[model samples]
Target: MTKDTIIQFHNVRFCYDEVCAINNVNFNILENSLTAIIGPNGGGKSTIFKILSGLLKPDDGHFSLRKGSTIGYVSQFTDFDLSFPITVLEMVLSGTICKKVKPFYRYKKSHRDKARNAIKRVGLEMYEDRGINQLSGGELKRAVIARALASDANIIVLDEPDSSLDVEAAADLYRILINLKSDKTILIASHHLDEVIDIADSVLYVKSTVTKFSSTEEVKEKLGGGIII
Candidate 1:
């Protein structure tokens, strides 16, 4: 891989049982650039996200991350048991727990400080100590993003961040993502074509196959008579 390349997928293929999740995909995510993976439903968008985040491995092909690269991931919101008490601060700090760190080890002061800063960055300072259940939908999404930022990863990947968010909330999240692109390579799996086209430095269009475009117009051209939205 080139020095500018932070993540590379060479002829990658992935499958789950009988379903083909990804098919012979190849792409390079440039350092410090914002890339958006956009496609229709069942277009293998989430599968690609999983592959890049290391949550799932490809069934075939080669995938590589640059040496010493760190990755942070923000997943979609799911049904959480509000009764399982956990503070927002604690949830964000959990990102700092490295693989080498023992589960029994307590988080240090530095970890707490980082979590606080992350929460502040996402404009959630007042909600730091609140229970996870207490946050509204937008607030919960911001808190999850704080956790990702707290990870301090070189590459940050988010899955459907705008899901279930109102228009204002989604716009706020997009602004945060645009700001973060300067410091970290940002990749998102989104169905929000307009938002993605506006901020993305490159576009990854996933279908039965995967294709990468350097510009929105290029992506539209390749869509071959299909509307971008």
Candidate 2:
């Protein structure tokens, strides 16, 4: 692999019990670039994130990352209760739960410091002590980003971050993403074309596979079909 490539998919293919998910998908993710994954429902967009995040293994092909690379997945914790009695700081700290631990195992003061710094980095310093249940949708997403930052991961993958937010909230999220683009390799699954067109350097339109991988400005012109989101 070249020094610029961070993740490579070699003839990647995936199948469900009987249906195909990804088909001969080949792509390369470079360092410090934002690649937006876009497609309709059940178009294997989530499957791509699952495979990249190690939540599921592809049936036929494989992916490889740069040595010592770490993926900070933000959307995998969706099953947890949003109303749970946890502060934003506590939730962010959980991102590195297994990173440093002793036999007794309580979150260290150092961990809290990292979480605090990450919260501030994401513009969530004011919400550090706020309850998760009381946060707005936009605020919660920023907190999740803080969690990813605290994980000390160079690659951050978020699945459908724009799913539930309003236009204003989505715009807020987009601003944070733009701020992070200078340093992190972000792979987010989103359908909002308005947001992705502005934020993504490259766009991966995956309809069961990679239909096109091109500059954001050329995607609409080259895709040969209408983009729903």
Candidate 3:
């Protein structure tokens, strides 16, 4: 791998229950670059994200990261039990805790401080003490992002970050993400065409049987009239 390459996937193939999710995918994500992955629903975008985050292993082929690379991931929103008692601060702190010790260990003060700064960076300072269940949809998303930031990772991956966010909220989130681009490589799987184009240094278009990687303008040209926002 070149010094610039932070992630490399060579002839990677992944399947789920005998169905192909990704096929012979070969790509590289450069260090400190912002890459956006876009595709139609059921196009295996999330599956690819899972692989990069180490949540799932590829069925065949090789995937490697630069030595000592650290990754942080924020998943798409899903239904959760509102009754589960956890504060936003506690949730963000959990990311730091997970990195330091096994799941059974208690959180440390340094973890709490890192979480607090992450919350502040996302402009959710006042909501730190609020119960996660009490947050608005946008606020909840911000909390999750804060948690990812607290991971102190060399790479950050986010799945469907714009879902359920209003225009202003989405813009705010994008600003925060842009600010983060200088510190680490960022890979986001999103269908928000306008947002992706605004921030992306590269774009990865995933299909059931093929994956294409290119710059935003190149992808737009390759897709022709299909590049609608």
- lDDT values, one for every candidate: 0.85, 0.84, 0.84
Q: Tens digits of per-residue lDDT for model 1 on 1-229? A: 9989999999888888998978999999999999988888888888888887888988899899999988888887664566668899999998877778676788899999999998988888998889998988788888888898898888988888887888899888898888888888999887777777778999988895887899988876776433553
Measure candidate 1: CA RMSD.
2.0
* lDDT string, candidate 2, 85-140, tens digits: 99999999998688556677788899999999889988989888899999988788
What lDDT tens digits, residue by residue, belong to model 3 across residues 50-152?
Answer: 9989989998998899999988888987745557899999889877865555666887888889999999988999999999989987788888989888988
Query: What's the distance in Å from true for residue 79, model 2?
Result: 2.4
Candidate 2 residue runs with Cα over 4 Å from true position: 76-78, 99-102, 224-226
Global CA lDDT of candidate 3, please?
A: 0.84
Error of 1 at 206 (Å): 0.4
What lDDT would candidate 1 get against the real structure? 0.85
- Local error of candidate 2 at 195, Å? 1.5
Best of the candidates, lDDT: 1
Backbone clashes in each candidate structure, one number apiece? Answer: 0, 1, 0
Q: Please identify model 1 stretches exceeding 4 Å from their true place.
A: 79-83, 101-103, 221-229
Superposition TM-score, candidate 2 onto the true structure: 0.93
